[model samples]
Every structure is written in structure tokens, then in C-alpha cells.
Target: MSETARPAGRVDTNMAHPARRYNYWLGGKDNFAADRASGDQVAAVFPTVRRAARENRAFLQRAVGFLAREAGIRQFLDIGTGLPTVDNTHDVAQRIAPQSRIVYVDNDPLVMAHARALLTSSAEGASVYIERDLRDPGSILEAPELHATLDLRQPVGLTLLAILHFVRDFEDPYGVVARLVDAMPSGSYVVMSHGTYDGVPAETVTKLEEANAASGGLSRPRSRTEFTRFLDGLELVEPGVVPIGDWRPSPGTRPPEPADICMYGAVARIP
Candidate 1:
């Protein structure tokens, strides 16, 4: 693909796309029949799948809020940003710090069509969308759109949610993460959520894996060891790597033990 030949404009609704399928699970309207069918198939096999998706979104909102309000982070680079849902990273961050600048990167065609929804930002902050592949970290970092929106000199929150799993061992997911983190300044944060089989029943994991395979989208359920490897050099926040619902959940809403959700969430600060 050429520098300008982004995978935007046309959306393939005939097949299930990761972002759109995720949107379907999140109860969003941007998905097509194929996405709904695939998502329903997975949800049927794993009844808690929808719950896990919502919990992950809640975690995203809370995490971004903390990064903006407490950590004083003013910029964000959200990779593999799925379909624009309620309270997107920019929304949560800019709500706390209006001047916060956010740049969202995703290669999904539906996400690209819905980029407009992601681009809306408060007057106090700035937002932009870039349709790019995270596998090419060099291109992602060097993209003019990214460079123009984010200040590399400042601490940035790099978000990779439900993404890295698509990149198998051959793709060197760890190295891809390292490339992005290495490019950021100290005090920066690496916030991530990964799907795993460590908590759920083997049958559920197998079913979801089969559905993802049939959809033609890459999906891999990593071990806790593999997930922690992504945060290799950073200082993990309190409570360490835990299930999404268990990551510093707010009052009144008690978190279920890690077994309830197959997704793991953790935030790490670059020292």
C-alpha cells in the first residue's frame, strides 16, 4: 500500500471485521449481518463474552480518566482502536484535560468510515484519525498524521486493547510492542487488555477460537506469562496484571474473581 493509499473509504460488510464484530458485542449499530452472525456465534458459545466486552470498555474509560486526571498525561496514541463506541479514549481523556491531544490508529475499513465519530474532540483538546496497521510500528510512528497530532517529547499513553492477540508468535508481537514503547519517553504509559484462556473453560476458548478462525480475522489467546511479557520493562500499576473487572474497579461494583472474564487488563508506566 502506498503512503496515501490507506484502507479507508470502502467497507467490507460481507465478512466479519474485528472492529465491527466487537461493536456488535458492545451493542453498537455500526456492525453488519456478518459481524453480528460471527459475534452471536461466539457469544452463544461463551455467554460471558458480552459482559467481558462491556467490562473492557469500562476499564478503558476508567484507565484513560486516570491517565489524564491523575498521571497528567496530555497525549494518547490508541492503536487498533475498534469501532467508535461510547466514551472513547479521547472522550474520557479530554473530558479530564481538555487540552489533551489524541490520535487514533486503526486499519479497519468500518472504523475508517466511522473515523468521523472518533475525531470529534472538545475545543480544549484535539483529535485526529489515522488508518494504519499496528504491525508496521515504524510506519505508524513515522506517519505524518501521528507526528502532527502527538508530541513525542511528552509522556504519551499508548493503548493496545484487544489487539496484540491478532499478531501471532511469528509476527513477534512482543517486538512490535517494544518498538512502540521504546519510541516513547519515560513516564509514558503502556495500557493494554488482552484475551486469554487462563481463566475461562477450555471449551469456551476453543469455540471462540474456532469462530474467529472462520471469520478470517486473527485471534490468539495468550497465557498470563505471555501477557506479562508485554509489560516487561514498565512498572505495573497497583494490583498488577488482573482481569479487566478486577483492575481497580470503582465502589459498589464488586469485581468477580479473574475466572469470570477471559480478558486481562493492566497499566504500566515507563520508568
Candidate 2:
């Protein structure tokens, strides 16, 4: 498939976006100075923010590898895909199974500018990007790009890592997740990671919340129980709902303490 055209829109370099800030945390040069400042502020309050970002990305690699190699899933629908990073969903999946197809969804204009990198697929596989928000599942499920690249009848690996926390409770995050999950076939998998204040100090939590508010983003860190609610009716994989660093860590990598990462991760299969 040809590369997707650069989307049209003026990037707001003044306001810090989660995708851009995350890119900064990951040591990427795709972020603006505003993003760096906002990231620094958050990191000042939560010094482990950078570590959590890296560990979360590692979790994504493991989960995608499992879905493509062990579960035999050839199609992927990765929502809230941040700025293109190393070992993206398609990269990991296609390495295991060259025939894997992937659809990346994100509303960030900067991400859209770099969508071509995400669209680069293996000789036998395909990848596409959709400029859309997580709140509108209907638009995502019904997108022509999604239909052209993926078969809804087959199993799809749905990835939502470190993105749902931005969806506030008022937006009905559960309903959004359910709509997307319900659209997938029975054998489909849901790989997810969410921010949590479970073990963190109340003062730190408050400061992090303040940082998010200052950045003009809404983030609601949920508990383990609340996070598990998103996986309702699905069968969890082994080592269920553990910290991101503990979810099948790569060889020679030491899992960080739960308080260090402060993010929960799990992979579940639709029965």
C-alpha cells in the first residue's frame, strides 16, 4: 500500500499533548519545546514517569508478540497509537507473522504527520492509520480504511496502552471499550495498560493530577478493580493484571517495583 497523505491541520505547539509528551519521555526528538516543559513538570512530580513509559512500551512489544505468534492473530486494531516509536504494533507483529495487518488510530496531528512510518508494512502484510479519537468507537469500527485493511470476521489484536486514562469517567470509557470489543470476533484479544494511583502516595497523586490539569489534559488514574472492570467477560492471560514491568519481561530485564511503574497491564481473550 502507498503511504498515507500528511493530514491537514496546524499542530498546536503551545499546548502539550500526551502523545508529544510521551515521545519526549521516550527520548524522541519529535516533540516541541512546550511538550518538553510539560513533561518535565510531570516528571518533577513523578520522577518515575520516564521509566513507566519505557516499561509500558516493553509491555506492548510482549503483548503483540504473544498475540501474533501464540494466538495466531493476523490483524490488529491499535487505538490511541501515539507518535511512531520503535517496535510499533505492526513492526512487532509482522516480524513474527509477515502477513499481519494493522490499523492505527489517533487524533493527534503530529502523529498524523508521522503516520507514514506506521504505514510501512512487510511485503506480505499491510498497515493503515486513521485520524480519529477513542471516544468515537463507531467511527473507528466503521472507517473505510479499517475495513480495507482488516476483516472484522477474523480475530483482531486490540491494543490500548497508556491511553484510556485520558478518557475521563464522564466520557463513559467503559462504553467506548465495550463498543470496540463487541465489534471484534470471538477469538480477538484485548491488550491494555492503564495508569493507577494504587500504591503511589496521595500527595504525589494530587501533584500528578495537577500537572495533567495544567497541561490541559484529563487523566483519571483508576484502581486495580476499576481497571479490571474494563476486562469484564474476557479471559485473562497468565499473571493477570500485574504491573507493566512484570507482564512477561524480556530476558535479562529486571521487573521494576510496583510503586516505580504505577501502571497496570494485562492481555485478555474474548471468549
* Span of ten consecutive residues with least summed lDDT in model 2: 1-10
Deviation from native of the Cα of residue 69 in model 1, angstroms: 1.4
- Model 1, 1-271: lDDT tens digits are 3446565456777888778888888889988999899888888888777887888899998888889988999999999888887899988998788899988888886686687654589888888887888888988998888878888999999999888888878898999999999999999998999988896777777787788788785688798898999999799988789888888899898886676678899999999
Score residue 93 of candidate 2 by CA lDDT.
97
Ten contiguous residues minimizing lDDT sum, candidate 1: 1-10
lDDT of 1 at 184: 98
- Which pairs of residues collide in candidate 2? none
Prediction 2 global C-alpha lDDT: 0.91
* Tens digits of lDDT, candidate 2, 1-271: 2234323457889988889989999999999988999999889999989999999999999999999999999999999899988899999999999999999988797797697654589999998888878998887887889999999999999999999998999999999999999999999999999999999998998888888888886578899999999999999999899999889988998899999899999999998
TM-scores for every predicted model: 0.94, 0.95
lDDT values for all models: 0.86, 0.91
Best by lDDT: 2
